[model samples]
Target: MAPQTWLITGSSSGLGTAIAETVLRAGHKVIATARNPIKAAQENPQIEELGGQWLKLDVTSPDTTKTVKDAICQAGGSIDVVVNNAAYSLIGSIEDMTESEIETQFSTNVFGPVRVLKGVLPFMRAQKSGTVVNISSIAGLDGLPSCAMYAGSKFAVEGMSESLSKELKSFGIRVILVEPGLFRTKFFSTFVEPAAGLNQDYIGTPLGDTLQHFKDLDGKQNGDPIKAAQRILEVVTCTGLGVGTEDMLRLPLGPDCFDRFQTKCDALQENLTMMKKIAYSTSY
Candidate 1:
């Protein structure tokens, strides 16, 4: 695989920063983006030391997306990868969350990547060689009760990525969805709350497991983000076609993710058998 240039959004901290650092350490140039350029720069000295470029971009903003794309195009003439990683969590049941909460989550997690993909698709097509990496969560494949907004947003991303892979294959653009499970990130700490009029007590029962996951993972998340980032880049840069889906599709990182994937697979197989046993009336 040839050395590539990576453009990663939300590079101020956590997974995005980890991705940028990994790319830089791999001797590839990176375009690190954040809503506040100065803050992002200040927060990531490692990236700065590595000479990675920084840009101001709020993924939820249409105008910013366009400008970031234009800037990227004007810079290295082409971008090898675009990692859409700017997103936040909204922890609440569907009814518990206000309209604004849902809108805000969708804006950042769903429409943000949609807007970035639109802006980059033309350039990637013209270049005929690029990768679009959408950072989704395990919640995307399996629903979590308290994370209705997050799950909905990630489900949108997963579906979009699945269709996009087929759609862009002819254009030489590969769409990979990164499914991370219980990574140690500030994402849980920053989750948006229900409206002021709403009661926080709703967070106790139905949302119990969801809240516990966050608390349990506070300092105990088994997912190492740095290694996760490097593994993702390695798979994306892998050579030849025979190695199969690892080259250009869903990449689930970490032990927790692996376990979840296996569990889902087993459950799916069991359910399929059960459905087969009851297919008589349904088949007609």
Candidate 2:
């Protein structure tokens, strides 16, 4: 297979760095982006050593579209794969979350990818081939207490990816959603924090428990970020486990994520079966 160029966001740590390393090792060119290039270099010191290019990209910034386009132009004017992986989880009860917090969550997690897509899709369309990988989470498949806002943002990504998959199918572009379960990464070590001010009314509820659960699971997560990155690379490159899955849409990593996906599908099936008559009546 010919070496392809990959552009990944949030490449400072966690899955982003893992993917960057994996792609570089496979002899592909990688353009890794982070909000702070200096800090990203500090976190993933091997990025430059591995021949991956680092660029400053803040998904929340209005200038992201231009930045991505410029980076692509600099990298020989062609991009084969794009991984939208920059996102932070905002854990808090819906009542405890302020409007500004909600907006920030969506702006970063939801609209961030939108900006990258705007910057790259036109080039992909002109070339008539490209893969778009959106890094989502298990929270996207099923909403959890204390993670409503984060889940809402992910759910929006899920919906948008589904729609984009259809819209771009004719153009030979594939859209994939990487829904991962808890993985050992800085995401838990540094990103997971409760709302600024906890609501006293909900202190003893599941919201509090969920927050504590994430803290306890920080360094103990069973999933491996490197392995996850490998699987993602294989899928994107159409090798190994991804050989026959060219049309597959969602790539759910980890047993935990698989089980959750099954549960959600089963519940949806049951609801459809039970509400078929009522739903049909409403149509008339």
Candidate 3:
């Protein structure tokens, strides 16, 4: 296969760095973007050493979007892939979070990817080929307590990607969403913190324990970021888009994700069937 180009966001650490590394190791050119080029440079030295390019991108900035587009164009024209992976986690009860807090989270988690996609779409359409990989979470597919806000952000991405895949299908662009369970990444804890001034009055209950459990799982997560990166690279490089994607757009990568997704589907079906019994009684 011919060497491809990549535009990876949040390349300073965790999955973003791993994904960027995998592409570089595969002999591909990468345009890695991070909020802080200095920190990104320090953490991901291989990007410089391995011949990949790095740029400062706050993601939320309009100028950064234009710069990314310009970079992709200047560097050999078009990119083969664009990975939307720059996002933070917000862990708090819905009641504990302020309206502004949720808006801030959505701005980054949802609007950030939308901006990146808009920047890349023109080139992809002109070339008539490109792949977009969105890093959604398992919580997106199944509602989980204490993670409602984060899950809402991811679910919106998943929903948008589904429509976008079809919207760009005729233009020859493919959209793939990877829904991962808890991974031992920095965002699980230190990189993220409980919402400022959480409602401690509701502490010592199941909800509190549930929140703590998620935080505690940070270091103990079973999924490996490196392996996850490999999986994403493999899928995007597939010769053709997979089957039934229009109906079911995202892929659940982690075992926990898949099982939980399945359980949720089953429960939904059961409830629907039970509703049918009540609603169809006139037919008897």
Candidate 2 worst ten-residue window by lDDT: 188-197
Global fold similarity of model 2 (TM-score)? 0.97
Give the candidate number with the greatest TM-score: 2
Q: Give candidate 3 regions above 4 Å deviation.
A: 191-196, 239-248, 277-284
Which is superior by TM-score, 1 or 2?
Answer: 2
> Which lDDT tens digits does candidate 2 get at residues 1-284?
89899999999989999999999999999999998998888878888998998999999999999999999998988899999999998886777777888888899999999999999999899999999999999999999888888999999999999999999999889998999998888777775444566777777788878777777887898899999999999898889988988899999999999999999999999999999999889763
**Candidate 3 structure quality by residue, lDDT tens digits, 1-284:** 89999999889998999999988998999999998889889877988898898878877786756887888878978888999999987776778788888887888889999889888999999999988899898877886767778889998998998889889999888888889886778876653434565588657866677777877777899889988888777777753343234334576777888889899899999999989968887783
- List residue ranges in candidate 2 displaced over 4 A: 192-195
TM-score of each: 0.91, 0.97, 0.91
Worst 10 residues of 3 by lDDT: 239-248
Clashes in model 1: which pairs?
none
For candidate 1, the TM-score is 0.91
lDDT, model 2, position 48: 90
Candidate 3, residue 263: the lDDT equals 95
lDDT of 1 by residue, 116-228 (tens): 87777878999898989999989888777677788899999999999999999999998889999987778777777677533567646768656666656676677788878
Return whichever of 2 and 3 wins on lDDT.
Answer: 2
